[model samples]
Target: MAPKRRRTVDNESKEAVQNRSSMVTRSRSAKYVKISDNNNSPVVVFAHGAGAPSSSEWMIRWKNLLADSLNAVEVVTFDYPYISQRKPPPKAEKLIEFHSDIVKMTAAKYPHHPLILAGKSMGSRVSCMVAAENGIRASAVVCLGYPLKGSKGAIRDEPLLQLTVPTMFVQGTKDGLCSLESLEVVMKKMKAVSKLHVVENGDHSMKIAKKNLELAGISQEEAEQSAVQAIAMFVSQTIGAM
Candidate 1:
């Protein structure tokens, strides 16, 4: 009888250990998200472009820049599951639910702070899709190089047209994916109040040529800094007017 009782106790203890380990694994995975330590409002959830991970140099650089430029309480960024899982990138529409979940989590975490959804290229397009969803209610959206056209030059303006929140676009003058003229036409049809910051001589990633930078008499960092400053101003004015 004693041996049977000991065996039962051992089984229970093993089950308990397994349960604890499972919980710890889940908690650790949740805690692994990328978030800044600053505890302040205007929490910005930035997303990465299709070609890079959240830890890529461009994403990391802009994440810090956004934090400083917006004086945000914190900036949250995450890689899309496809990138992490090494799967092919899906259409922007397919990513709405996943991206919205991240925004929902971040919004819940900082319930009292102003929420801003910003992203790079394809991420920016998805950000617009997520922002246009019914309950997300972001205070504003800042699109960094929004991909407004397909590779074949089909216009993708439906998401932009649906936004109810104030929006700001940081577009490069030379971005082929979103020609300023086409963007202007779409902007005319948009219901949301919108603003644009044009980066002179910049391409899709807002990368200005060295010669152009020299001609403009500003370093690459300086050009980006100017864009960041424009973002800061737009965020400030938009939020203040709200």
Candidate 2:
């Protein structure tokens, strides 16, 4: 018997299909692979922040940048089931289960490609938990704006410390969601290979002040370019070593 051939989607057709498919709504469905070029590149799964959808402006921007700059990598973003609700959000356990299921399904779909897990804020925490609990081996994990504590100042410390994969934490110096001091402490305790990059004057969303941008004559686009460059470099180095 002969082996079955896989169907490959072209860049143009994939874009058209994605645009048309974006209209179909599911009550608790998570969005997947936004702004893809259909290049069938290595997959990078992205998780959105708490209270935000996968199509939020920031996520969309990042996805597009990755598609344009790293055309060989497909960026997939998914919303937590709680964020898709019409009413109150679901409990933490339910949210974790949803994230875990999405990761598993994605990994199965792209079984041969290198899988990278990337997340923002609460989403990053969930990604770390999924990686740890399932014993799943990702090429690398990238965390943007990781939250280290609750709004009321209570500390949460399991995600970073228990990670087994090569992880990179990209944080803003002025981010209010997570304290650099606390994150540093956690990083010091971690057993896995970890690295942190602090964007000077960047806020929780990696937005910088106009004054600073003007002083350096660096536009917001440039800042985003810098971030993408850093992430791409890290991904390349880590994947190469592996």
- Per-residue alpha-carbon lDDT of model 2 for 165-224, expressed as tens digits? 877777777899887667766766776667665565778877889886666455667666
**Per-prediction backbone clash count:** 1, 0
Pairs that collide in candidate 1 are 40-73
Give model 1 RMSD, 1 decimal: 22.0
Instruction: List candidate 2 segments past 4 Å from native.
Output: 1-41, 88-93
Would you give me the overall lDDT of model 1? 0.77
Consecutive 10-residue window with the lowest summed lDDT within model 1 = 1-10
Itemize residue pairs with steric clashes in candidate 2.
none
Candidate 2 positional error at 125, Å? 1.0
Among these predictions, the greatest lDDT belongs to: 1
Most TM-score-accurate candidate: 1
- Could you tell me every candidate's TM-score relative to the true structure? 0.83, 0.78
